[model samples]
Structures are given as C-alpha cells and as structure tokens.
Target chain A: GAGVSQSPSNKVTEKGKDVELRCDPISGHTALYWYRQSLGQGLEFLIYFQGNSAPDKSGLPSDRFSAERTGGSVSTLTIQRTQQEDSAVYLCASSILTGEGAFFGQGTRLTVV
Target chain B: AQSVAQPEDQVNVAEGNPLTVKCTYSVSGNPYLFWYVQYPNRGLQFLLKYITGDNLVKGSYGFEAEFNKSQTSFHLKKPSALVSDSALYFCAVSKGPGYSSASKIIFGSGTRLSIRP
Candidate 1:
C-alpha cells in the first residue's frame, strides 16, 4: 500500500458490544502503533509492536483492551464491553523502524452509543 | 516514561507575523522530540524532530524548532504566519529503551493554532 490503511473508517457500537479495529501498516515498516484520541483530548498511546518482539502494552488504559499483530504486517485492536468513554478516534501509525518519523492513517472514528 | 505537554490549548497569530507554540517534555533517557501538524479532518503530518546534536532543527513548511535541554522544551516557530498555517499542532516524545523497542511516541493534547489574515 502507498500508506498506512485502517478498516471501518467509522464504527458505531453498543456500549456492551465488542469492537475490533484493524490496521495495515506500510509495507516494509518494522514498527506499528495504536493510539486513541477522545473528544477534546490528546493522542493516548495504546500499544506498540516491533518486529518479532514483545509488544509494549503498558499504555493500554485497561485490561479490556488488547491488540495482536500477525506476520509482522497487520494488526487488530480489540476493545471488550465498550463503554461510552470508549468513543474516540482510533489511529494507527507505522514507521520504517522505531525512533523514525511515523506515518499515520486517517483514523477510525469509533462511537459507542 | 516520556511525555510531552503543550501548554496552550490555542494560539492565535496574525498573518505575516511571527508565531510560536510552546512545548515541554519529561524523558528518562535521551529526548527525541517531534512536531506534527494536523489539518481539518486529516491525519497528522510530520513536521520535524530532535534526536541528538544541534539545539536548532528546521523542518517542513518553513518551520523551525529550538530544543532547549536546560528547559526541556521544544517550541515550534515560524518567522511569518499564514492563514494556511492554521491547524492543530502536536508535540511528541519518544519513549526510550526499558519500554518498547519500537520507541512509542507520546503526544501532547495538541494546540489549535489559528493564523488569521
């Protein structure tokens, strides 16, 4: 792909439902990341995955949130029992490698009704 | 843990005038600071970064930033502002080792910069 791509640009889910956001990082990128931006808030780091390494999940807001990257190419972020506070723009980014400038996707606007 | 703080939520500047957006950071290791601009309904675009060496670094759109280690600040500046420059600006810091090898970047709340003509 020419750039990072995210699926389901917008999602509206019930408060108790589970939602999965996906990211396809730029080809050859060794690093992928997920962040969330709540209304009027900043980009909150959620998770980071580097080639074949353990992902850093310290930034995940709660245990309800989890992510997995397979084949070092694509990733999926899952949020269980979504709450109203979960309404936010989920952003995905990929860098040539960690510590380099990262390119971002347009983002998926997740709204929990 | 590395974090960035964009002090002002909004900054207003007049066209052809100089503009500045303040940023401060806290990092455990070497600080890697960055600036990004987000246009309306668009994704963030990279502006510049400070990895090592020089205190002054220049970036896209005729913008520049000064890294002051003494102050732990990396302020974005432009000699002349343009209405097109109006956008949401963010400052970010890279989390060093002991965290993710991927070097996760922590972003600030963002400052809405409005350059009026």
Candidate 2:
C-alpha cells in the first residue's frame, strides 16, 4: 500500500503476557512516530525515530513500553506484562521530515483481558 | 511547550447548515497548527493547516479554517454541513520554523461533530 500499514488490526491478549505491534511506514519516509489512544481520549505521544538520531521516549507511559525502528523503515511496539490500562489503539505515522505532515495508519487495537 | 485545545466536546448541526469547530493553541513563538478528522474505526486524516502566508486556509472536502493570531484560534468552517461530515475532529500544534522541534504533534481532546439529517 502507498500509505502506512499496520499488522494485526485487532489483538486480544491475556494479562501478564507480552504483545508486539508492528508498523510499516511509507517508503522514503525518514521520520516515524508512535502514539497511544484510549477510548474517548486524544492521542498521547509515545516514541519517535528520525533517521539515525536518538528517539525521544518522553511520552512513554512506563518502562515496560518500548519500541524500535529497524533499518529506518519497520517499527515495532512491544509491551511486556500487559495490563488492562495498556489497552488502547496504537497509532503509527510516517512523514518525509519533521516539518512535513504525517500519514497515519489505521492503527492496531489491542485489548488486554 | 506546544499544545492545542478544542473547547467544545461535541457539536450538532442540521444538514445544509453552516458549521464551525473552534480551536485554540499555545506555544512559545509561532505555531504550525493543523486539523485532522477521524471517521469510525479509522486513523486521523489531515484536513487543513496554517503555516505562514494567508490566514484563511482551505483544505479538503470543502473545509476551511481561519487563523486568528490575536484570538489565538483556528476555527474550522464549512459553508454547508453534510450528514457524512459527522465524525471526530482534532486540532494539533507543532513548533514552526526557527524553533528546533521534532515531528511530535500534540492533539486536542477532539470534538465529536454530529450532522443531523
């Protein structure tokens, strides 16, 4: 697809288990971002990867949450020991640069039970 | 710091009626603001943006927004509302030129727009 693509549109995971969400950004995009959106809430910034620069993890809610962008293309968000509060739609976006507008994926909806 | 706010949580308008969605922002110097919309079970779609040039910016789907520096508001406006326009609207802000900021965008709480038939 020309736009950003995410895998496993929906996931139901058991608590205390681990889950990984994947995102494939648009080709040629140098910047990628991850955000969390709970029900009836706005998007919360998570981590960001820009070229070879260090990612900004300021918005990461906890240590258990981590993400990595391999080869500056594919990105994965991993959550360990899933908790109910961790349930939300994980959104991924990619852009040509920091100044350019981003293209978003449909996002992965994860539910922890 | 940079942030955006949508004062109304929800807005209702009859079909063919004019509609306006209010948005405000606060940032250190100038702001590069944007508006996005989301339909049911979808990610956000970019609508319009206010960068430099003109204060009145036109966007997709017959939607336009006026940037008011004095009021610090960028209200999305449509001449005629359509039933299909019912969805969630978000206002976001980022650091503009001269400021060293990343692609991080701060979104508003989102306003649920309901266009009645």
Candidate 3:
C-alpha cells in the first residue's frame, strides 16, 4: 500500500465487549509498532514487531491487551473485556528497518462506553 | 532509561514570526532525536531527525531542529511561522545500542503550536 492503513477509523463498543483493530503497513517495512493515545496524552508505546520475531510485548498495559502480526505485513490489536478507561486512539506505524523513521497510520478511535 | 520532555504546553506565534518548540531529552549515551507534527484528527508526520553529523538538521515542510548535546536538547525551529503550521508537535528520543537494550523511541507530552495570523 502507499501508506499505513488502519481499519474502523472510529469504533464505539460497550464495556466488557471485545474489539479488534487492524493495521496494514507499507510494503516492505520490517518494523511495526503499536501505540495508544488517550485524550490530551502523548503516544504510549504498546508493542513492536521486528521481521516476524517474537513481538516485544513489554508495553502492553494489561493482560487484556494483545496484538499479533501475520506475515510481517498486517497486524491486529485485540482488547478483551474492554473497559471505559480503554477509550482512546490506537495508532500503528511501520519503518523500513530498525532505527529508521516510521510512517504512521491515521489511527483507530475506540470509544468504550 | 531514555525519555523526552516538551516543556511548553502551548506556544502562540504571529504569522511570519520565528517559532520555537522546546524539547529536552535524557539518555545514557548519544541520543537519536526526532520531531513530529500532528494536525487535528490526523496521524503524526515526521518533521526531522538528528542522528549524527551536523547539529542542524532540516526536514519536511520547511522544518528544522538543532541538536545540542551539551544542553541535552533538540529544539524544533522555523524562521518564519505560518498559520498552516498550527498543530501539536512532539519530541522523541530513542536509545541506541550504545545506550540501552531498548530501541523503541519514547515521545514527550507534546506542545501545541498555534500560529496567529
């Protein structure tokens, strides 16, 4: 694709419901990152995938937050039993390689009501 | 640990006047700094990066940032401000192998830049 693309630009889900956010990164990018942005808050690192290696899940806030990248191209962020505090924008970015500038997607706005 | 700080929550500048967004960083070793801009309801766009070499590095949309190792700062600067430049600006710092095992870039709280016409 020309740029990073995220699906379901806006999502409103009830508490305890499960939500899935998808991200398709630019072609040939080996490094993918997931970030969460709360109202008036800066980007919070969530996870990172580097060329199909075991993803760095250190930043996942809780056990309910999980993500997976398939074939090193597309990724999905899954939130189980979502809470009101989970309402925020989820952003995805991909870089050609490690230590390079990353290109970001428009992001998915998730509203947990 | 590597972290970034954007001291100003908001900066008001008149169009055609010089604009600056302050940024400071803390890292164990040499710092790889980056500046990004975000408009309303849009994703962040890379403004510039300071990897190595000259202290002054230029980037997209007529933006530039100066890397000052002594001060532990990399402030974004524009000689002449434009209304279109109004947006949220973020400063980020990453720890290279020389510094720490974590290679992820950490962003600051962000500064809102408003250009008054």
Candidate 4:
C-alpha cells in the first residue's frame, strides 16, 4: 500500500462489548505502533512491534486491552468489555526502522456508548 | 525513561506573523526529537526530526525546528503563519542512536496552533 491503512473508520459499540481495530502497515516497514487519542488530546502509546522481536506492551492501559501483530504486517488491537472511556480515535503508524519518522493512518474513531 | 512536554495548551498567531510552538524533552540517552501536525479529521503528519546533526532542521510546509541540547527543547517555528497552518501539533522524543528494539516514540500532550487573518 502507498500508506498505513486502518479499518472501520468509525465504530459505535455498546459498553461491555468487545471491539477489534485493525491496522495494515506500509509494506516492508520493520516497525509498527498503536496509539490512542482522545478528542482534541495527545496520543497515548499502546504497543510497539519491531521486526521479530518481542513487542513492547508497557504502554497498554489495562489487562482488558491487548494486541497482536501477525506475520509482521497486519495488527489487531482488541479491547475487551469496552467502557465509555474507550471512546476515542485509535491511530496506527509504521516506519522503516525505529529511529526514522513514522507514517500514520487516518485512525479509527471508536464510540462506546 | 524518555518523555516530552508541550507546556502551552494552545497558541494564537496572526497571519503573516512568525510563530513558535514550544517543546521540551527529557531522556537518559541521546534524544531523537520530532514534530508532527494534525489537521481536523486527519492523521498526524510528520514535520521534522532532529537525530544528530545541525541544530536547525527544515521540514515540509516551510516549517523548521531547532534542537537545543542544552535547553532540552525542540521548538517548531515558521517564518510566516498562514491560516492553513492552524492545527494540533505534537512533540515526540525517543532515545536512540539507531535500531533499538526497546525504543519507542513518546508524545507530548499536544498544543493547538491557531492562525487568524
């Protein structure tokens, strides 16, 4: 793909429901990251995956939040028992390497009601 | 741990005037700083980065940033502000010389830049 891509541009889920957000990183990118942003706020780092190394999950907010990157390409961020506070935009980014600037997707807007 | 901060929540500038968005960071290792801009309903766009080079770094849209190691600040600046330049700006930092699996970009709280005609 020409750029990073995220699916389900907008999602409306009921509280306590599980939602899965997906990200398709740019081809050949060795690094992929997930971040959450509240309306008119800063980005909160969630997870980072680099090549074949174990992912850095220190930023995950809670036990209910989890993510997996399969085949070093596509990633899925799963939020179990979504709460109202989970409503926000989930952003995905990819870079050729860790030190390089990362490209971001338009983001998936999740609304938990 | 590496962390970045944008002290001001918002900045207002007149069109055609110079503008600056402030950022400061802290890190144990070498700091790799970056500036990103986000327009409404859009994704974050990379502005510029300071890895290891001259203090001044130029980026897209005629924007530039200065990396001040002594001050621990990377401030984004533009000579002439345009209405179109109004956006939410973020400052990020990572500890790096390169290719470190443990390194991840840490972002600031963000500052909203508003340019008025």
In order, what are the TM-scores of chain A for the candidates? Answer: 0.97, 0.98, 0.97, 0.98
On TM-score, the leading prediction is 4
lDDT of 1 by residue, A3-54 (tens): 9999989999999999999999999998999999987578999999988889
Of 2 and 4, which scores higher on TM-score? 4
Q: Give stretches of model 2 more than 4 Å off.
A: none
Better of 1 and 4 by TM-score: 4
Residue B29 displacement (Å), model 1: 2.1
DockQ of candidate 2 is 0.67
Model 4 ranges off by over 4 Å: B98-102
Please tell me which predicted candidate would have the highest lDDT against the true structure: 4
Runs with alpha carbons beyond 4 Å of true place in candidate 3: B97-102
Q: What is the C-alpha lDDT profile of model 2 across A4-102, one tens digit per residue?
A: 999889999999999999999999998899989999788898988888889988889999999999998999999999999999999999988655677
Clashing pairs in 3: none
Query: TM-score for each prediction?
Result: 0.95, 0.95, 0.94, 0.97
DockQ scores for all predicted structures: 0.72, 0.67, 0.57, 0.81
Clashes of each: 0, 0, 0, 0
Per-chain TM-score (chain B), model 1: 0.93
Tell how far residue A53 is off in model 4, in angstroms. 1.0
User: What tens-digit string does per-residue lDDT give for candidate 3 at A1-108?
Assistant: 999999999999999999999999999998899999998779998998888578888889999999999988899999999999999999999988445678899999
| Candidate with best DockQ | 4
lDDT of 2 by residue, B1-117 (tens): 677889999999999999999999998777788889999977899998888889999999999999898998999999999999999999888777677756577789999999999
Question: lDDT of model 4 at residue A57?
Answer: 96
What TM-score would you give candidate 1 relative to the actual structure?
0.95
